[model samples]
Every structure is written in C-alpha cells, then in structure tokens.
Target: MKTKLICALTGVGLLLFTGCTNLAEKVLDEASVSGLTDKQAADGNIAPVYARLPDIFQHTTYFALQEISTDEAILPYRGGTDWGDNGIYLALHQHTSTSTDPNIRNTWLLLLQGISRSITAINTLPTINDPASKVYIAEARGMRAYYNMVMLDLFGIAFLKDDPQATSDILRGEAAANYIKAEMLAVEPDLLTTVGPGRLSKGALWGLLARLHLNYAVYRDRYADTFTHKPEDMDKVVEYCDKLINSGQYQLSKDYFPIFNSDNHSNPELIFAVDQRAELNGHNRLAYFSLSGDQFPIPAYVGANGTDGPAITPDFYQSWVSAYAGKDPTVDPRFYKQNLSIYSNPGDSCVAESAFNINRGILRGQQYGLIRVNGAFVKCPDGKYKVGKLFNTTRNKPTLPVNFTEKIDFTVAGSDYSTGYRVEKYEFSKKSVSGRNLGDADIVIVRLADIYLMRAEAKLRKSNDAAAALADVNTVRASRTVTTPPPALTSMNLDLLFRERGFEFYWEMLRRTDMIRFGKYEGTWTEKTNTDKQKRIFPIPQTAIDGASNLPGYLVQNPGY
Candidate 1:
C-alpha cells in the first residue's frame, strides 16, 4: 500500500524527498495528512533533509574543496592532460580560488536546499495529528541546525529562513555556533538515542555538540594566532564526549578496517553516517578515487573507471615514516591493511597471484592487478589469474615495472600525476561477482574514536594536562589491530596532537578544518606556498548572489572574493 501526501508549499522550494513513491493520490490533499500515523509521514519528510549531506561528501564537489585545498591531498593533472579543468584545481591548491568556482557555488545551493526542505517539513509535519509528529518536527529542526552548521563552517555565514518566501538572514561566527548547539541540545531528548548510527541519535547529537565546542574558539576567531579557548567551551566539549561515552551504546572497534569497510552501517564506531547502499544512492568514489586506472580491485565488475585523483601529499606520507622512525611502523594498526581474498570470485583468487598483493595503507611500491589480453583476463593453465605490470596510456610507457613513487613534485611535468602514493585506507568491496557494482560503504561522519580524540584535545587545551591527553590517545592506539604501537608518549602538546589527527583521519575530509584551527592553513606546503588569512573561509559564490534576483544584495560574497 502506498500513501501519497502532497503538501502544496508556497514559493520556491525543494521536494522533501526523491524516494517515498508511495505518497500518491490518496494522501495528496491537505486534509488527508490527518489520516496517516506520524511515523509514516515522518519518514517521508525527513529523507530530503538528510539527502543534502551526500552532496557535500561527494567526490569532485564540496569535499574536493575541503581535502584538495589542504596539505593532505592533491588532484594534479595526470600526464599533463587529465583532471586539467583549466587550472581550477591548481587555483584551489594555491588558495587563489575566486567566488566563481563551481564547487563553491554548488555547495551553497545544495546546503540551502536542505535548509528549505527542513523548514517545509517543520511547517507541514504538525498537521499529521499524531503525538509522534512533534518528535519528527524536533528531528527536522535538529537536521536543519546541522545543515546550517555545515554552511557556517564552509562559507562563514549560514542562510536562515522560517519560510520559503521569507528574506534569508545571515548568521556567522559565534552566533552561528550557538544556534547549532542550542538547536541540537533542545531536541536531543526526543531524538532516537538508542536506535541508530545512521539516524540522528543522541550520540550523534552529542558528537556534533562536542565538535562545535571543541572548535568554538576557532570559529569565534578564525584568523587569530593564539586562539582564545574558553574554559567553559572546553568543559562543554568534555561534557558532551562523556555523554556519548557514558551512554554505553558505542565503543572503539578493535580492527580499524571493519569500521570503514563496505558493511559499516552496523559498525559500533559510527556515531552517524550516510546510509549509503549499492541498491540505494551509493557512489564508489570513496573506494577507488585514488586508485590508478589499471589497478582493478574487482575484475568481474565494470562500470566507471577510477578517477586517479586526490593522492596523499608526499609530506603527509613522510609524516608517518618520520614520526615512527625508530619504532616498527607495522604495529600502528591505522597505517596499513593488507588485501586478503575472502571472496569466491575467480578474479579475487587471482588477487593472490598479483605481483604486489600487498595493499599497504599508502600504496607506494609496484602496483598490481588483473591484466587484460584481447579483452580477456590473462590466466595460467592452472586457472589462477596471471598478474602483470601496469601501463598508463598518458605517458605511453611501461615505467619502473609500474612502481608508484612515494614522492610527488607537482611542479614537474608528468612527475605530478604518478609520483604520489595513493590512499588505500578504505577497502575495496570484495563481495560476490554477481553482487559487485558500485561501492556500498557508509561514509562515516562522527565516530567514537573522534569523540575520544576531541575529549583529549579539549582537556589538553583547557588545562594543559599532557598526561591525561596522552592516555586518551593511547586508548585509540591500543584498540587497533596493529599491536605494535609506538612507545607511550612521555609528553603531549598541540603539535603532537595535530600530527596524530592527520595520521588517524587521513583522507576523511577533516584536514582543512584541522589545518585552520592549528594555524597551519596559511603555511607553505608543496604547491601551497601562498598564505592568505581570508582564504580560511571560502567565498560565497558569485553565482549565488546573481541568482538571488528577487532580493538585491541578499548574498554578499565572503570578504576576499
């Protein structure tokens, strides 16, 4: 049975959801909202609000603006041809991007879409007439605040409107931070604290609140050298982290890969994540974006090729090597995960035969995968797959037997594309040949480990207690599968904490924010030699301003742009 509830919202607005095809003829009228239970319509309204998040995380979009612009990753033109969007990427890496950057514009539009839909849901949900309706309304408001928080983080100003036709108001700095914190805190009592890692549970709310307070000083004064950290704010951060820890619903996982694997929806570490599935709205960019075109993790599956994008900076790669130089690096579980065939596919069985079956955390040595001869996989008479060297069409040469160097000098020709080590943190989906297609891994947003890390940083910053901070970090190191950990730190400081965060969350899209707060964003690194404090917050896209024809001067571009 399908229920169709169509609320004719006035003015320019967004449809609440792309799914829920059931909302049809029967529930199309305004009066019909009374006929269905609140839970039923709640699912219908809340979907589109959550839908906006996938855009920010999608590869080649807003996520590109965050990670590629930092010292952690780069999307240099491959072989002097590929990913050459007329210097758009180069501009981003150098902090020379203007308001006309497409990514900046798209992010603004996508976030506003969420804000609009949430308002619509809040306005329409009450008429459902079930007590459960109020709960959904609260959820809608929580989601709205979360979306605004993201906007404020990226653009320095969040657009606010109670109705679709209302003039958009701006909130920035501390005001925006307080708005996000208060909204989440007010409604969290009714949020599903016990029900989900996918849905906005109380744990998720607390994790976000903890992040807001922990970074409160940064948001309050982004360009300041000695950031003013309020004890009250840091105390609130500790309080929220404790809330999640005491809830007893989440824990740090022993094996790091499982927490980020294809089936991570059930992972205990995931406080909140996008419920991405292959059958639903799932994109595999996370799994294979950094992979070279020739390295096929799944031979039987074919659709789109790897983008070969956003390789880790040589600087970031060396950070690990230098940090654990004296100790055995293998003991740090987060640094590496070897590829082992647990699938029945004949292609996977061939993975055992590849020249380099080693799927190290940072892919630096000779790359290995399936070889195609005459449109058929080359296999030995014994029926095992035959692994061979890689050849790139761009360079038109078989170099070093396909060895990927750990160093990337972006200024050099052809050297930029292939030099840097590829990121291999997220595992390729190794399901059956029949089931394989796009990636199905949930994109983790807030995890339990990050909560602990936040608490430790809050404590370190608040009271300068290095011993207590070290203990919190050690707890994460102890839980990983890699048993060979670096010796317990004799002391802890801000510099050490920042380095640890880079190692822990590489390629997870927190680098820009981390760099800003650490006062390292303006520093020279590889291609990013220019330093501009205004570049910390991205410009409000000029396209957004021009599109708001109805309200003149409604969207002022960010300071520099």
Candidate 2:
C-alpha cells in the first residue's frame, strides 16, 4: 500500500522522500513516523537534509566535479562510449563544461532541496513550544546554513526562505557568506554540545565556521589576483577550531583507513556526517563505483561486481609516488599497502583476509588479491585457494588479470576495463535492498581530521605560526603511522600544505576548495590546462534559471555561463 504524506503544503512534505532508492522501506519509515509525538516528529524532521547528500556526493555528482576538476580524479569514457554521456565528464576534465551539464543541474537541484527541507523542518519543529525542541530547531537552521554555504560555493548564490510560504531571498557572494556565518553563530549556543555525527551540534557548527572563515577570502574576492585573507576572519576560524578541539569530545582515528570504512560511525574521528547506512537511503556508488565487475568483495549483497565509473588520475597517484621517489610508497601511512601476499605467492588465497582489506584509500599498482569465481574464491590444486585473474564481466573470461595498474586511454580498445587507480573511500554495504544501491559507511561531511588541518592552515596563513601549523600536521601523522610517522617539515609553506591536505583528505569533496584557496584551480592538471578564473565557480544550471519564478530577477548566473 503506497501512502502519501498529506499536509497543507503537500508538495513540500512529499519532498522528504525524494531520491529514495527503496520505496518499500521508505513507506515503512513514513508509517512509523505517524506514531511519534509533535516534538519527536520535529526532531526527526531534519533527516531529509541529510538524505539529500548522496545525490550530491554520489560517484558522478558534486564530488566528482570537485575532484575531477583538479589533478585528483577523472571519469574517462569507458571503452569509448559507455560513460560518455555527450562527453560531460570529458568536458568537466577539460574545463569546458557549460550551464547545461547534467551534473551541474542535478547538484544544484539537490542542494536547493536540502535548503528547502531544512526550512520546512525549522518552521514545523518550532510548533511544539517546548524548550527541548530548540536543539532540533538549531540543527535545522545549522543545516540550512550549511546547505546554503555549499550552494553558494558552487553557484556563487544561495536561496533563503524562512518558511515554506515565504518568498525565496537570494544571497550572493559575500552577502551569502555573511548570512551563513551569522546563522551558524546564531545557532551555536543552542545546539547540542554532545557529539552527534549525523545531527547538527556545536562541534559541527565550529567545523563549518572554521571552514567558512578559512575560505572567507575566496568568497569575498573570488577573482582577485591575491585573495584578501583578513586576520580577523582567520582569528574566528582559530577561535572556533580551538573551541571544538579543546572540547575533548573528538579525536582523529589511529588508522586513517578505518575512518572511511563501513563501520566508521563508531570512530571518534567523524564530527559531522551524512548517516548513510544500509537502513537509510545510502548509496554503494562510492564503494563499488570503481571496482572491477570480477572483484566481488561481498558476494552475497552485491551479486554483480561494480558499475566501473570514476577512477583516480595518474597525476594524483604520481603526486604520492613521486614524493617517495626511492622509499616504499606503502610506508607513508597514508599510502596504505594492502594484503599483497595473495598474488605475491601464487596459489595463496587472500580470501582469509577480510574483504575490507585493501578497499580503503588509494588502490594502485599490481593488485595482488583474491579473484571471485562462482560467487566464491578460486581453489588451488592442493585444496587451498589460488588467486587468479579477475575476468572482465563483459567477457567473463580468465584472460585479463585483476592487476590494477596506471595504464590506459580515454577511448575504446585502448583504455582497459581498469585504467588509473581506484579508491573505495566509503565501505561497501553488504545488506541488499531491492531496487537500491546503499552503502554501509556513513559519508562524513565533517570529521576531526578536517578540523586539525583547518586550524593548521589558518595558523599558517593568518599568524605565520609554522611551528604550530607543523605541530598540528604532525599530530595527525603520528596517530595514523604507529611504526614511523611522516617526517615533520623543518618549515611550512603553501606547497607543502597543499600536498599534506591531499594526503590527509583526498576524495572527500575537499580538493576543489583547497585548490581554489591555494590558487591552483587554474593550473594544469592531467587533461585540463590552466584557464579562466570564472571556472572557480560553476555555471548556474540553465534549468534552475528557467524555473526561478520565485526569485525572478534575483537569480543571476555566475560570470562564465
């Protein structure tokens, strides 16, 4: 029985279920929602804001736009025409995408949906007139500020509406930045001080503020030759970062890989995350998006292997490899060397090693691991198992090995089914839901590691405290590498900072912003050459411009498109 939520604002209420991968589960969720009290309902109302993220961060959405726009990653046309959706990914890589790009349109709509949902929750959650509901109200407002910030970052404008019936107000450039900063500050006091990864809290607020202030110069002057980084704004970033860090509530995880694993929510590292569990409308795109069809990690849940979409660029992989010119790449803590014992010694089955072994961080080089056969491991003649070639699903033959190496082209017969490095940043979800592709790992929007880096950057840029900045970087490195931490820099500089950030937080929807702030957005990277400053902010999707009846004259496109 399909049931629709009816309210005075029927359309607005219905949007809560938008992009739901599973209808049966979503209907059941809505069914149970009726039993909750007004306060409970209000508290639960902000969930839609979180639900809208996977659509934004999915394999080929905003996250791809962010990473692929730089030297980090790219979505090359597989076998010439498979991923070639009118050359959108190619255009994005070449810095030639226009307003009509599907990703730009989809990302814009999803972000706006987040803003609308937050406003709906803020208006509805306040009805209980109870003091306890204020936290939820604050969370909703914080989320609204967050969604607006992201929209502003991408489109250079943010849409604001206090209530469902109100006219949408457009905040552009610095005005949008200020409004969002003020909103976060306003809600900071009322938010829950306790640690809550998915829900908004004071820690998340501080993290957001630190991020906004650190990038305030760019928001203030996007096209300037030299971005004006106000010391005052930098101080705000420091203040909030300190408050969150000093809280003693959160800490960076010991191992970097686990933080991106399926059960990452349990770690103290995540400050704010989109709760993307199998039970939720989460996606498995992040996990299996790049995996070969034959490399079945979890055979039961994902009957097939992977969709074979995006992959890491040779440039990004080289950045890490080049750094350790002579030394072992695996020793760099960040360069997670996986269970190569399986293929290194033939006839040895690494099926004994968990599926989650090399699934985290950058997957590169001669991939020595198990080959799935008959939905299980391939057995050796001695009854023990043998690692074999991962047959391409299209051919389903044992001809091609699962040896993931950095060699391939943009088109047909040239670019092998596997080209460039693959990253399973989010762990795969084993529990299958019909008509859905949900991953278990909660996609962390903000984590403790980000805070440390933010603080370090602010210190370096604002106060020129290299010692302090280097200290912050060392702390994270020390924790992750128990055997031998990364050698701390004798000095600090922007180039070092850029590489450090790439190492600490690659593939986390942060590369673009980091590149912009460091003025590297215009530099040559892989397929794209250094180009226009306007490319810093994407073109406002033309569809959004066409439907701006509410903000008729207010919705202006970014300079480029």
- Most lDDT-accurate candidate: 2
Identify the runs in model 2 with alpha carbons over 4 angstroms from their true place: 1-36, 129-131, 350-359, 373-386, 393-397, 408-414, 433-436, 481-483, 549-552
Which residue window of length 10 is worst by lDDT in model 1? 14-23
Candidate 1 lDDT over residue span 1-561, tens digit each: 345454323233332211122323322355655565667677677676676666567776666877889988877777676778877887888899988787776666667667877888888887765666677788788888888887888888765667755665677888888878888889888887765776777788889889888888888887687688899999999999998888889988878777877788888889988777653654446766787766666655433234567687777877888888876455566776656432223354444333323364777666666665545667767777665556553245545345667666555553445667787666566553422234577788899889888888999988998888899888887776445544556678889999989878887878898898878999887788888798999887665555554456655677878
> Against the hidden reference, what TM-scores do the models get?
0.88, 0.89
Candidate 2 lDDT tens digits, 1-561: 245442222232323212322322233255686677776665566566577777777777877788878778777777666677998888887788898998887787678777877887787776665566778778888888998899878878866678576656777879989999989889988988674687788888889999999999999988987787999988988898898889899987877778877788778989988776645765547777777655665533336456667777777787877767787666676766454455465544534434334445677655544455555666555554455455564445467655566754465543566777777666566665421267667787888878888888888898789899888888788887544666665667778888889988888889999999998888886677858998989988776565453444655778877
Cα misplacement distance, residue 126 of candidate 2 (Å): 1.7
Name every residue pair that clashes in candidate 2. Answer: 283-439
Q: Report lDDT (Cα) of residue 341, candidate 1.
A: 38
Q: After aligning candidate 1 to the native by TM-score, how far in Å is the CA of 48 from where it should be? A: 1.4
What's the true lDDT of residue 554 in model 2? 52
Stretches > 4 Å off in candidate 1: 1-38, 302-305, 340-360, 393-400, 414-416, 430-438, 482-487
> Candidate 2 clash total?
1
